[model samples]
Target chain A: MSTAMGNPTAGASPGASPGASLAGDPYAPQQDTVAGPVFTVTGQDWDAVVAGAAEAEDERVVVNMGPQHPSTHGVLRLILELDGETVTEARCGIGYLHTGIEKNMEFRTWTQGTTFCTRMDYLAPFSYEAAYSQAVERLLDIEGDIPQRAQDMRVLLLELNRISSHLVAIATGGMEIGALTVMTIGFRERELVLDLFELITGLRMNHAFIRPGGVAQDMPPGALEQIREFIKLMKKRLPEYAAFCNANPIFKGRLVGVGHLDLAGCLALGTTGPALRSTGYPWDLRRTQPYWGYDTYDFDVVTWDSCDAYGRFRIRLEEMWQSLRIVEQCADRLGNSEGDPVIVADKKIAWPAQLAVGSDGMGNSLDHIRHIMGESMEALIHHFKLVTEGFRVPPGQAYAAVESPRGELACHAVSDGGTKPFRAHFRDPSFVNLQATSILSEGGMVADVIVAIASIDPVMGGVDR
Target chain B: MTDPDARTDDDKLRAGSRGEAAGTAKQEPKVGSTPQGAERDLGVQEEMPENTVVPAGADSLEVIAVREGMFGVQGSGDTSGYGGLRRPVVMPGASPRPYGGWFDEVADRLADGLGADAQAAVEKVVVHRGEMTIHLRREHLVTTAQHLRDDTGLRFEVCSSVSGVHYPEDTGRELHAAYHLLSMTHNRRIRLEVSVPDSDPHIPSVVAVYPTADWHEREAFDFFGIVFDGHPSLTRILMPDDWPGHPQRKDYPLGGIPVEYKGATIPPPDTRRTYG
Candidate 1:
């Protein structure tokens, strides 16, 4: 890790002074020194010297704000230069969470990349998988109208993930501001969401459940019932959240007007999700660039024009409700399309022809195998070839963008007609969104920096990846 | 075969006149015929119609010739020859448009401003597989992109993505850069592709146009070794600064990492390992 030490003072070098006036000094030799004794005794000279000394004393102080700070949210560091308590300038220092997942994905097969990419943005694992899978599918040119059931399942899982992610954001943001109960409630609720995920995907954190062709498995029985119950429970719990945090006078005092970013600033800096919507852009990808049957769904693009910290908080809260609406619609869609194929028919991109024993200790029915192997030679051949060699993508490039919990998650993939991607770059929202923290924190009190950083809600994994 | 000189004369005639341009060119009529390239087990290329319209004029003729040659070498599969699935539906710019709603109107305005020579240079307007890729003469790429940004129907104010591709075996330019632009108000996307010779992969920088393009172009250059003229800062991003050769090129070897996870040794990239 290399460190960059920026210059801290004027007149620290030979070229420190501005160019001499051309009208007066074109032919004259430039002065290399002050051209006077160390102490000239005129009254104005004495005042000027005193003022310069005082100014030098008050120049600026550099404070490293992270790599392990409480308010940083993750392992982010902001090197801030302050004039007293007000921040003069702030430079964001990141990459503390560098996992080399993008490079690692090059070594893995196309399908295995999902397992690694999904973990980049832990809060929005589905969004990461969706973006990566979409890019690979574009390379293979295999967008075979993913089944309606699969689309609905994706929407359901994505929305649940969104709610779970926002709970963490709000919880951590509150904890940073000394609201202990919010953290407790937020984690408690998030645990329930993770429990739901564990039941459905069989893993808590890196659920490689969402793959290229489709989901890894069909929703486990009673998973929908649990989700429905969770939704009902959340409808009641949301008000408690509001009463505990949103409506609290102290919380409002800390958040409402601090870290204001208007629409123009948000757009200029490329902020999105709650940060952009709070500034009144209302540019949700689901509403604008609809993918995964989002065009068929009905939900409001939530927005708040206040462009303040409180506005961001308000937008996320409302977004949870909108997500709930999406979840309910997805549940209805899934109920109608039960027992359908979760994976697409293209065995080249789908999972291998094998089954795992269920919790009930029984493998999938023997008929499934006979139908795959004995019934369809093409399917069998594709399975054998794909499992052995993996899919070969044509030499091309694809950029797939999805609405992640934080903001737009775009994956730009390039292939050289090979089994592995040549280059896979993730335009993570957290990385870009963190840029606004400097703009928001400038001239604000040092204490407000914590509030501003929290409002941005950057996950270092997403930032550094 | 017909007289070659007569075909050139007919091509000149087609270039001179707009109404007779599509018909007068005496080249083989298999305009969009699929190429018969070496076959791989993976069915990647999609087949195209033999007599698809090829745009008239010198630049368009060159692009069509290149596209045809690509297809000739690589046999077009069952789908459209323009890569990927056959004719993916394009989401047209809708009225009362959702997100960046003003893109279509802006793109049109830009095209009109570029006038006929530049517009004629555009070879194919493809909206296959849901991606909008505009094929244009390599010479007119920067100019067309400028027009797209400045024109009315296509105010692609944001160059959201810029990437490179390598095709070592191809006869024409083996390296290409695909630029994705977004009209924030219009909510439309247009992809601009520029191909340069692999021997000296170079293209004009769009950094002066879109600031966000700086890092993306650098990354492309870093991985693919594609050079951008007049870029502010061109340097390696994800790889070590002193690394040799472009890692993303087709001929470059994929390096491996040796690791044992749960008592299983992960083999390197060169070693054969079943994906499943």
Candidate 2:
């Protein structure tokens, strides 16, 4: 390939920074008077350049960390300008995993939207599904008609998802800082939650269980008992994290006062979740702007006063405890909502098939098949029409937000009175909070950049979507 | 930028005033008898007979397009026998006064905040589905945002999201950017929308007011090509830097590349037959 075509920096440069190229590109490469050679700072492969340039006597070296770095989290690439060990500037290169999920949703039916959104934030799939479903329900003018049993089930799933997501955040944060035991134990406890999820929704991740009007179906037999047992197990396993790392001097020395951002900084950068809560402000969407019956839940919005990475870590740990409390309450509620319908009563909006596990694995129940195929021709037509064309939403727009483990995951849905959405946009917290990378890591040590980004815990799936 | 196939599909989905006789086959009597182009002028005067959920008053409704089939099909593939489904794709038009609840209070405060330029700044206030949207001209977007952030009565602290929508039919204003602002102090939310023509898609950047708008604005510009003129870094955030065109625009195809199956080439999604 020609140098112009092989070079990724030949086109537009980032911001107002002059592009760095050896040829006629507007961002021409600057001469390195004392170094090996001057290279453009766009490509992900920079180890060879770094090695050759480091041999020089220069103190200022620009390092291109990975779009594939194991420590920088998912596909995030960090370009750090280091004066020896101190980072003077930091820039994030994202969009390595853009799948155009939002654009794809415009062509599919509204019910099919949940399947796509659930895959956006892979760690917190339930949060995205719930937010999208709530938006669709609001646009359909049937928000009040969602059954109580469905609402309770959503609460149950959301709380469990919160626990699992926070576990991964803490686990990955620990592993990035060389604490492998936390990673091992975190996934161990997370597996129990996943087991319960598998029992309930039939998928460990990307469970499209939440639908537009309600959940896909009611819970199976012994699902509640399994949840009760999981909650009991988590209650015992919860304090092990604090006992392991809370008082560990090495962990505190590595994380304390690293990646510090105050309340004003958090608000300015639109950072929410534990990162914002660590600044001693109790700003949670569930408490301030309640949705999906979260207002009725008995839980506290945990906060830490350090305004640093350690505080954010502590906040996540405490928040997991609070999530466990909410899960307990949801289990009690789900137990009382026995035999209640989980989907809406509106036949037009509700999914017709009552799903059952058959010889073919999972398909429409035999009873529903008999009614639609044998008993009533109208039932067959209704099922076919609803399945193919889906329900229509009135022409308008609604914004629904849910507090995901990361932050506020909001879905903005606009319908032009069609079976599919006219425009749908998700305000992914990972995408927004990631803008704080420079602010958090600029004046900090180069090694602390990992701690800073890990504290934010941005999942690149949500960021790129 | 002006792909003919995309425009045809757009017109088929929302058959604006052009009203080409694409799917005018086997007209059912109950659907409509009004001719294609004349429906735009005549239908604007009376409440649509069907679709009761649409608020009454022809003045409030903006008839984006007049449809003539159950499914938005251009040729003879619509065999559902419901070809005569001629309903105008009507958006909830500008809402009237009283606005209700906190919406009126926000409008009054924003007007006070905008001062002398309030009349020129705000084109209209639309309250739909309990959400308030203040449609503003692109020129006054930054000033209005600053006031909304600083004004004590209207303290929308966090600009949670910035999204772009492309309306190819809305002739002078094909590109729209909506800013969803949340006020943590008052615990309320409001949206501000600005529209610009496709010829000159420029809107003043609100990054100075809301620092969080930096990335969101970049994403919007990458997708819709709406330029936030004063942005610090007006580069592509999602798409590749060398990408040919904005992929999220209505004129851009969904772009499903054909897959090669076992000894056969499967058609792309856009080329395949589709149901409603």
Candidate maximizing TM-score: 2
Query: Which pairs of residues clash in candidate 2, taking residues 3 or more apart in a chain or in different chains?
Result: A19-A27, A21-A29
Q: List, residue by residue over B23-96, the lDDT tens digit for candidate 1.
A: 12233221222222222111131243222222211211221112222121233442434342111101111112
- Could you give candidate 2's per-residue lDDT for residues B10-73 as a string of tens digits? 3443433222231122211111223232233334434555532353321254445444565556
Which lDDT values do the candidates have, in the order given? 0.67, 0.81
TM-score between candidate 1 chain A and the true chain A: 0.84
lDDT of 2: 0.81
Give per-residue CA lDDT, model 2, range A1-465, as digits (tens): 001111223223221222223345546353332322445544553443444444445556566787878898899988887777799889999999899999988888899999999999899999999999999998887889999999989988998999999999999999999999999999999999899889888889989999998999898999988888888888899899999899999999999999989999988989999988999889899899988788999999999999899999898899888988888898888888898999999999998876898898866699999998899999999998898788888877778998999998899998877788888999999999999999999988999999999999999999999
Fnat, model 2, is: 0.69
Q: Which parts of model 1 have CA positions greater than 4 angstroms off?
A: A1-56, A138-144, A346-349, A352-354, A358-382, A392-396, A415-419, B1-108, B115-127, B135-147, B164-176, B195-208, B214-218, B221-254, B257-266, B273-276
| Model 2, residue A54: C-alpha shift (Å) | 5.7
Clashes of 2: 2
